[model samples]
Target: MADSNDSQPGAPVPCAACRGTGQVISNLGGSPSQVPCPWCEGSGTQIPGHDAQAARRAAAA
Candidate 1:
């Protein structure tokens, strides 16, 4: 297994939920479907500890 925190400090990190693919697989009844990640919105980059809401709040402040 590789380290999750491989990016440099202050750099935007790849999304963990999608592994930077910007998409995720949902298994239902053994069938897998691809859907855009709620985080990163298909761009596949995220702030270290920031979610969408928090990012928005920070931007607003």
Candidate 2:
């Protein structure tokens, strides 16, 4: 039997911060710029210790 915890092994879910784009908008100094997502470290996947619920809420905002 396959593991129940993971629907697809070796296939991680997309990063909530970057929305799988591996980048996010940086508004530093009142200027908008694209930067690698710090949460996933630019891998575009959900990493351990990432708070999915909070990320979703932040994305919604």
Best-matching candidate per TM-score: 2
Give me candidate 1's TM-score against the actual structure.
0.52
lDDT of 2 by residue, 1-61 (tens): 8567767667698987799999999897799999878788788988988665685577769
Note each model's CA RMSD in angstroms: 8.6, 7.2
Candidate 1, residue 53: Cα displacement in angstroms equals: 9.4
TM-score of each: 0.52, 0.63
Residue runs of model 1 more than 4 Å from their true location after superposition: 1-9, 28-30, 47-61
* Candidate 1 lDDT score at position 47: 46
Q: Candidate 1: minimum summed lDDT over ten consecutive residues — where?
A: 47-56
Show where candidate 2 strays beyond 4 Å.
Answer: 1-6, 50-61
Model 2 TM-score on a 0 to 1 scale:
0.63
Colliding residue pairs in candidate 2: none
How far off is residue 45 in model 1, in Å? 0.6
